[model samples]
Target: MFQLDPELESFRNDARKVAERAFAAKAAYWDEEEIYPMENLKLMAELGYLGITIPEEYGGSGAPVVQGTIMLEEIARVCFNTALIAQGAINGPSRAITVLGSEEQKKRWLPGCVRGENIFGIGISEPGAGSAMTDMITSATPDGKYVVLNGQKCFCTGGHVATHIMVFARWGKTQGPRGIGSIVVEKGTPGFEIGHPGPKMGGRGVAEVELFFDHCRVPVENLIMAGDPDSTRSFKRLMSSFGPERVGNAAMCLGVAQGAYELARSYSLERKQFGKPICEFQGIQWKIADMATQIHAARLMIYRAATNLVDGFPDPLEAAYAKLYANEMVQRVTNEALQIHGHYGFTREFPLERMVRDSRGFSLGGGTTEILRNTIAAMVYGRAFDQRAGS
Candidate 1:
C-alpha cells in the first residue's frame, strides 16, 4: 500500500552500488574461507551503515528501522556475511544496549558499535533450550559485589570474534522465565570460555559457537534490566528486541531471492533451448513472472513490517508475518531460479548453488517456521499459548 520515499530509495541505491562493487566479488571467498569479514565490516562502518537504528547523539545515523532493513537487503543481495556485519550492530545485544542500557553504558558501547569497532555477540539460545526459552537453566547468583554466572550457551553467533557478549541466565533458581536477566561479559572474562566455531551449511563466514560460563564472576554493574529483585518483568521486555531481529532476517532473505531471480531473468534471455532463447518458452516465462511477483510481495511485506513499529521496534506479529512468508518464499524463489538455469544452476560457477545454501539458514535462525506460527497465533488471538500444558 505504501512506497519508499525518494530519500530512502536513494539510500537503497547507494548501498546496492557499494555492495555490488565491494561485496559481490568477495562473497564466494568469504563463504569458502569461513573467516570473518572484518574488512567489509570496516567498509560498512565507513559508509555509516552500521547501527542504522541507533540515535545520532550516540554517533549513529539514528535512521528508522526501515533503513536498517533496506541496508541489510542491499548488502545481502551481494554478500550475506557483509550484511551480517551491519546486523551485528543494529540487532541483538547492541540494540538492547541502545534501548535498555544506562546513559553511561550507551555512551561506552553504542559509539563503538556504530563505528564498527565493536562486535557484540548474543548468548541466549542454549543446547537444552531454544524455542522454549522459559526452560533455560543457566544461573547467575548474587555475590558480595558481583554475580557469579554458571551455564552453557550455544548458537552464540559471532561469539568467536565479538568484543562483548550479552548473556541471559537465571538470576536465581527460579524457573520458567522468572528471574531471567542478562549481563555483559567482556572478552577475556575469567571462567568464560569460547569454543571453536560450529560449522554451518550457510552463513559460512560468520562464526557461531558455544560459550561456557563456569563461575564466571562479573561486577554487579554489568547486569542490565535487573532492577526487579524477582526479575519478573524483564523477560518480555528483553525478548521484544527479537521483533526487529526477525524483520532484519526477513530482509536478508528478500535480498537473496531477488538476487537469484535477477540472475535467472538474465540467463533466460541469453540461454537458448531448441534454437530459441529460453525467454520464449512459456514455462520459463511463468516461473519468471511468479518469482517477480513473490519478490515484490516480500519487499512490500518487509517494508511494512519495518516501517510500522511498536515502540521503535517491529511488532512481533507483523515481523512474524513478514519473516514466515519471506523465509518460505526464498526457498521456492531460489529453487525456481536455479531450475530456470537448468543443470548449470547445480554448479558453483553460477552462484545459484550458493544462493540456495545461504537462503536456507534464514528460516532456521531468527525463529523457526514452527515457532513463528506460534508467535503469529498468539498475536492474533491475544493469548500466550503454553504448549507444555496439553489442552
Candidate 2:
C-alpha cells in the first residue's frame, strides 16, 4: 500500500473537508451554468492552496510537489472544473517561473501568485503545433532591449482571465526545438490580445483561449534563461518542467476516478433492484471491486511518479507512464461507474454524466496517450529505436 507522510495526509484531509464544504455545493451549478467558480478560488486561496508548492520566502508554504498532488486529488474529487482551474492557476505558470525565472522575475511574480493576486496562463500548443511542439510558428525577434513576438497560441487554459502568460516561441531565425524558448507577456501589453473563451465538453468554468501576438514587445528581462536565443539547452530546461506537469495531470485523473468509484459504491448499496439492494448482486459487486482495484492502482502510480520528482522535476519516463495509465484508467472507471447508475447516470440530475464528460479529456490533455506511448517506448528502447519489422 502506498502511504503519505503525516503532513501530506493532514493536507489531504483538509483538502477533502474543504472540497466537501466549499466546492461540492457549487460544482453542479458551475457545470450547469458554465460559470467560473470565482468564490471557490477565493476559498482555495484563503486555505493556502494557491501557494501549496511555492517557497516560503516567496509568501508561500514551501510544500513539496507531493503535497500539491494530494491536495489536487482531493479537490478534484468534488469538482473537476475547479481542480482544472487550480492546476493552471497554481502549477502551470508558477512551476515555469520557479524553475526558469531569474531571481528578480521570481521576486516580482511568485509573491502575487502565492497570494492569489496574480493568475497566469501557459501559452503553447499553437494551431499548427499541438503534439509536435517544435513545429510552432510563433516567433520572438530580438531587438535592442526587447524581443518582438508574432504568432498565435491556441487552447491556452485559463488564458482569458490570466494576468500574465508564459509564452513559448521561436527566438530569432533558429529552427525547431533549438529555437524555442519561453518569455513572460503581461496582460494588456501592446499587440497582445486574448480571444473569447472556447467552449468545451468538460472543464466548463475555466476558459481555454487563443492568444494573438502581433509585434508584441516585452523587455529583454522577461526572457527566461536569458542567453543565446537559439540555445537548445534553454529549451531542454523548459521541457524538463513537463515531468511535474504530467504527474499533476495523473493525480487529477486519479481523483476523478476515485470520486466516481465512491459514488457508484454508495449508490449500489442504497439502490435496490428486484426487491433487494444492488450491492447484494454478484454482478454489481464485481463491477465495484474492479473500479476500486483500478482506482488504487492509478493512485499508486501517481504517488510513485510524484515521489520520484528530482529537484521538483519528475523522471520523464515515470511521469509518462503514470499519466498514460491513469488517464486511460479514469475513462474506464468513470464509464463503469456510470453503468452502475443505469439510465439515471445519463441525466444531468446525477453527477456521473458530468464525471464521464470530464474524464474523457484526460487522455487528450497534458500530452495525448499516443504521444506518451511514444515517449515511453523511446525511453525503453533508446530514442533511435525503430519498431518496424526486419529493421
Candidate 3:
C-alpha cells in the first residue's frame, strides 16, 4: 500500500526510522498527558525534520514536498497527533516567513525555526472571522519604530505554546478586506497574552487557544507580507501556502483512519463469534473491503497532490479535491471500522473511540469541508461561491 518514488525512497526509509524510533517513544506520554510532545519535537529537530520545507541555506534540509508528505504519512500511521504537531510546527508560520519575510526577518527567525528552537503559529482566524478572512478585526497601527496591535484571535492552534505568531490584521483603523496585512509578533511582548485554552473534541494534545493583544507592540520590521488584502500577489501567497496546510490535515485524517482500521482488524481477528474469528465472517469481510478501498483511494489522492506540489504545479483545485475526498473518506472509513468493532469501539479500550473523535476534527480544521467545497466550486466555475448568499 505504500508507494515511494525511487528518488524519494531513501528519504522515506529515513523518515520511517525516525517515526518508528522517536515518535513511538513519546506517543503514549503525549496522549496520556494531553500535552505537546516536546521530546518528539526535540528528536525531529535533531534529525533536521523541523526544517523539512525551509531552505538549505537556512540550515534546513530543503526537502521536496513529496519527501515531506511521505514523512507526514508515515508519522501519521504511528502517531497522528505527533504527525500533526510536526506538520504545523514545521510548516504553518515558517512557510509564511520563508515566502514573505524581509531579509532581516528571515535571518532572525529562519535559523531558529530550522533548529527547532523557535515555534510559530498562524493567527488568521478571529472571533469575527473564520472562513471569511475579510472580516478580521485585529488592527495594527503604526507607532514609530513599532506597530501597536489591538484585537483578539480565537481558535488559534499552538497559539499558547508558540514562540512567535504570524498575525493577520488590518493596518490602521480601516474596515473591510482592504486593510488586511500580516505581521510577525513575538510571544511575551508587553501586551500580548494567551487566554484559556479551548476544549476541543479531539486532537486534545494540540492546544488551541485565544490570543489577546492589548496595545501589543511588534516592531514594524517584523511585518513580513504587508499590503492590502486586495493585493493579488499577497493573496496568491496565502493561497499557495494554504494548499500544503490542507494536505497536511488530510494526512492526519488518513492516519487516524488507518489506525482505526488496524484496531478493528485486530479486534475482529481476536474476538471470536460462535465458532470462529469474526474476521472470517462475510459481514466482517465486507466491512474490511470497504475500509481498505476507501483508504487506498484516499492514499492515492494524497500522493497525487504531493506529486503536483513537487513538480511546482499550482493545482489549488486538485489540492482541495484531494483534501476534501481524503477528509470525508477517512471519516467514513474510521466510523465503519468502529462499527465493525461494535460495543468495544464505543468504549475506551480500543483506540477507535479516540480515532472517531480525532477524525471529526479533520473536517473542521484546515478549512471546513463545506468551505473547501465552495472553494473547489469557485475554482471550477470561475466564479466565487458566496457561502453566505442565503444566510
Candidate 4:
C-alpha cells in the first residue's frame, strides 16, 4: 500500500540524480558558508523539483503527496538545507494555492511558482503568536477595494527571496480564529519589506527573516477564503490546505534522521576501536540498532500521515504527531551519529556537524514538538484546551 508507482519511481530516480549532483557540488559550501544555495535552487528549477507536487495544468508534475514526500526525503538525505528550501518554498505554497486559492489566483500564482519565477513564503508564525494563533497582533482593516495590512511576521523562511507571501492576519474581528484571514502579497509592495535576516544554527542556507507590513495594501480578490469574520470555518479551511505542508516537514525530518543513521552505521564499521571495527563493539551496535528502529518508526508515521492527507481526510493531530516524532527522532539520531564520529564530527571537516545543526531546527520549525503534544492530547482527550481557563 505504501509502495511507489513505477512512474513515481522513475521520478524518484531522476530526483535522486539531481540530489546527488547537488550533494556533490553544494553540500560543502552550504554547511561551510551557511548561505542559501541559489545555484542549486536554479538547478532544481531546471530539474522540475520545484513543481513536483503541483498540477500539470499549472506547469507542474502533479505528483501525489506520497511521491512528493519521497522526493523531499531523498533530497534531504544529501542536503538538509536544500530539502528545507524545497519543502518550504515549493511544497507549502504550492499545496496552499492548489487547495485554497481561487481559480483566478491559481492561474496567476501557481504557474510562476512551479516555473521558479515566483518564490513563495508562508506568513503565519508571528513573534508572539507562535503555537497560539489567537495571539497574533497583526491586523487587517477593510478598505474600499483592498485590505490595509499592518503587522510584523517573524521567522519567515524565503524572506529575502520570496516573490509572494501568504500573509495571515486578524481582520478587525473580535473572535480569535474567526478573525484570521490570509492574503497573497507580492514583493515590492510599498509597505512590505523584510527585516535583517536572522542567523540560524541549522538550515542556514534558508533565510528566516522578519517581515514587516506597514499599511500594505492588498486587493480583496487575493483573499483565499473571503467570508464573514465571525466564523472559524476559514481558518479550518486553511489548516486543511496546510496538511500537506506539515507532512512535507515530517518527510524532511525523516530524511535527516535516515541520513544520520547511515553516516553513523558506516562510520561504526570503518572506524577502528581498541580491536576490530567499532561496529563489533556491543555499545556501538546497540546505538546503531536504536537509531535504525527510531528512524523506521518515523518513516512509517510520516507515510501514514501523507496517505491520510491524500485521501482528503487528514487528521491534523496525526500530522502533528508525525512532525513531532520525526523532528525529535532526527535530533537524537544526528547526535548519535556525531557521537559515533567522535572528534571528527565536532569539526567542520565532516557533514555530521551540519546534520546535527540541521536536525535540531526540525524540533522548532513547522509545528513545534511541545505545541504538537498539546494538540495530540487534545485530540485524544476530546476537549478544547484553554490556557486561560486551565483546561
Candidate 5:
C-alpha cells in the first residue's frame, strides 16, 4: 500500500475529522435544496481549510499540494459540493494566479481568495470549442490601456458566483492555439454578462453558466498571460498550471467512492437477509473486496501524481493517467456500491443514487475520458497527434 507518511496521515486525519463532523451532517441539505453553500465556504475559511496551498504571506498556510489534496478528499467524502469550492480555493484557478500572475496581480487578488471572500472561476470551454482548444474564436483585442473581449464561454463551472474570472480568448486575428491566451474579468464589469444558471445533474450547489463578453473591456495589467503569435508556448505554460485541477478532481472522485464503500460496508453488516447479515455471503464479500482494491489503486495513482511534481506542479502525463483511471474507477466503484444496496440505491431517500450521479460528472468535467486517452497517447509517443481533419 502506498500509504501517507506519519505527518501526512495525521494531517489527513485532522481534515477527515473536520469533514466527518462539520460537512457530513449538512451534505443532504446542500444537495436537496440545490443552493449555494455559502455557510460551508465561510466555515472552511474560518478554519483555514480554504487556503492551505496559498503562501502564508497571502493569509494561507502555504501547505504543499499533497496536503491541500488531503483537505479536498476529506471534504469530498461527505460533500462533493463543498469539495469543489475547496478545490478552487486550493488548486485549479488558484495555481494560475500564483504561478503566472504578477506580484501586483497576486497581491490584489490572492489574499481575498485565501480568505474565502473571493471566489475565482475559469472560462475556457466555449460553445464552439471544448477539447479542441485551438478551435476557439473568442477574441481579446488590445486597446490603449484595456483589452476588448468579444466572445462567449459555455459550461463555465463557477462563473455564476465567481468574484473574478480568467477567460481564454484569441489574442489576435491569428488562428489556432498559438494565438490563445487569457485575461481576468471581474464580476459586474460592463458588457460582461453572465447568463442564467444551468442546473447540472450532480455537484448541484455550484451553478454552471454561460458567459458573454460583448466588447468587455478590462485593464491591460489584468492580462495574465499573452499568447505568442509565433509559438504555442504561452498556451502550454498556462495549461501546465492547471495540473491541480485534474489532480484535485481525481481526489474528489476517490473520496466519493470511499464514502459509498463505507456506507455499503455498514449496510452489509447490519441488513439481515437469507437468515443472516448480507456480508456473510461470499458474493457480497467479493464485491466489497473489489471496490476497496480498485479504490486503493486509484488513490495510489492520484497520490503519486500529486506528490511527485515538477516546479510544484503535477506533470501533464501523470495527471492524465491519474485523472483517467480515477475518473473511470469512480464509475465502477460507485455503481457497484449502488448495486449492493439493491432497490434502496435507486431511491432518492438514500445517498447512493446521488453519489452515482455525482461520480458520473467527474469523468466529464475536467476533461472527457476520451480526451484524456488522446493526451496520454501523445505523451507516450513523445509527439503531438493531430485529431483534426486532413492533418
Candidate 6:
C-alpha cells in the first residue's frame, strides 16, 4: 500500500475538510449556472492551498509537489470545475514563470498568485496546433526592444478572466519545436483580444477562449528564454514543465474517480432492491469491489508520479504513464459507479452524471491519450514506431 508521511497525511486531512466544506457546497450551482467559484478560490488561497508548491521566499508555503497533488485530488473529489480552476491557478502560468521566468518576473507574479490577487492562464493549443504543438503558426518577430506577436491561440483555459497569460509562439525563422518559445502577455496589451468563453461539455466555470494577437507588442524582457530562442536547449527547458503538468492532471482524474466510487458504495448499501440492500447482491457487490480496487490502483500511480517530481523534474515517460492510465481509469470507474446508481445516476439530483461528463474530458486534455501513447512508445522502443504499420 502507498502511504504519505505523517505531516503530509495531516495536510491531506486538512485539505479534504476544506474541500468538503467550501468546494462541495458550491459545485452544483457553479456547474448549473456556469459561474466561477470565486469565493471557494479565495478561501483556498487564504488557507495557503493555492501555493502549495511555490517557494516561501515568494510568499508561498514551499510544500512538496505531492502535497499540491493531494490538495488537488481532494478538491476535485468535491468539485471538478473548481478543481480545474485550482489546477490552472497553481500549476499553469505561475508554474511556467517559476520554471522559465526571470528572477524579476517571479518576484512580480508568484506573490500575487499565492495571495489569489492575480489570475494566470496558459496559451498553448491553437486551432492549427493541438497534439502536434510544433506545428503552431503563431510567430514572434523581433522589433528593436520589443517583439511583435501575430497569431491566434484557442482553448486557453482561464483566458477570459486571466490577468496575464504565458503564450507559446515561434520565435524565429526556424520551424518545428526548435523554433518555439514562450512569452508573457499581460491582459490589456495593445492589439491583444480575448474572446468570449467557448462552450464546453464539462469544466463549465473556467472559461476556455481564443486569443488573438495582431501586432501585439511586448517588451523583450517578457521572453522566457533569454538565450538562443532557436536552440534545442531552450525548447527542452520549456518542455521540462510538462512533467508536473501531467502529474497534476492525473491527480484530478484520480480524485473524480474516488468521489464517484464513494457515492456508489454508499448508495448500494442503502438502496434496497427486493428485500435487503442492493449491495448484498453479488452483482452490485462485485461492481463496488472493482471500483474500490481500481481507484486504489490509480491513486498509487498518481502519488508515485507526484513523488518522483520532488527529487527532480519528473521523468516524462513516468508522468505520461501515470496520466494516461489514470485518465482512462477514471472513465471506467465513473461509468461503473454510475451504473450502480441506476437511473438516479443520470439525474442532476446526484453528482454521478456530472462526474461522468467531467471524467470524459480527462483523456482529451493535458495530453490526449493517443498522443501520450506515442510518447510512451517512443521511450519504450528507443525510436518512433508507426502504429499504422503491421508489425
Q: RMSD for each model, in Å, please?
A: 1.4, 2.2, 2.4, 1.8, 1.2, 2.0
Candidate 6: misplaced stretches above 4 Å?
Answer: 226-230, 310-312, 385-391
Off by over 4 Å in 2: 226-231, 384-391
Off by over 4 Å in 3: 1-3, 25-28, 172-176, 229-233, 310-314, 389-391
What is the TM-score of each predicted model, taking all chains together? Answer: 0.97, 0.96, 0.92, 0.95, 0.98, 0.96
Residue 74, model 2: Cα distance from true site in angstroms? 0.4
Candidate 5 TM-score, C-alpha based? 0.98
- What candidate 4 gets wrong by more than 4 Å, as runs, is 310-313, 389-391
Looking at model 2, residue 111 earns an lDDT score of 88
Backbone clash pairs for candidate 1 read none
**Model 4 compared with the native: what TM-score?**
0.95
Model 6: per-residue Cα lDDT at residue 229:
53
**For model 3, what is the alpha-carbon lDDT of residue 56?**
88
- Give per-residue lDDT, candidate 2, residue 5: 79
Per-residue C-alpha lDDT of model 2 across residues 169-246, encoded as one tens digit per residue: 987666666878888999989989999988899888886899999999999888885424546787778888788778
User: For each candidate, what is the lDDT?
Assistant: 0.88, 0.85, 0.78, 0.81, 0.88, 0.85
Q: Number of the top candidate by TM-score?
A: 5
Q: How many angstroms is residue 330 displaced in model 5 relative to the true structure, after the best TM-score fit?
A: 0.8
Which candidate, 4 or 6, has the higher lDDT?
6
Model 2 residue 368 lDDT score: 94
Off by over 4 Å in 5: 389-391
Error of 2 at 329 (Å): 0.7
Tens digit of lDDT per residue, candidate 4, span 1-391? Answer: 4666688789778777878866646776876786888777777778788887788988888766778788899899899878877896556866788877789988998888776788888888898888786778788888999989999998998678888888888876556777777888898988998888788788888879899999999989888765347788777777676667778888988888887788889888899978789999899989999999999898888878877764353468778888888888888898999999999999988788888888887777667778788878988999977754465
Model 2, residue 315: displacement in angstroms? 1.3
Residue-pair clashes per candidate? 0, 0, 0, 0, 0, 0
Compared to the true structure, candidate 3 yields what TM-score?
0.92
- Per-residue lDDT of model 1, residues 61-179, tens digit only: 88988989999999989888887777777877778888788898899888998888778998888988888877888888889889899999998888899989998888765878788
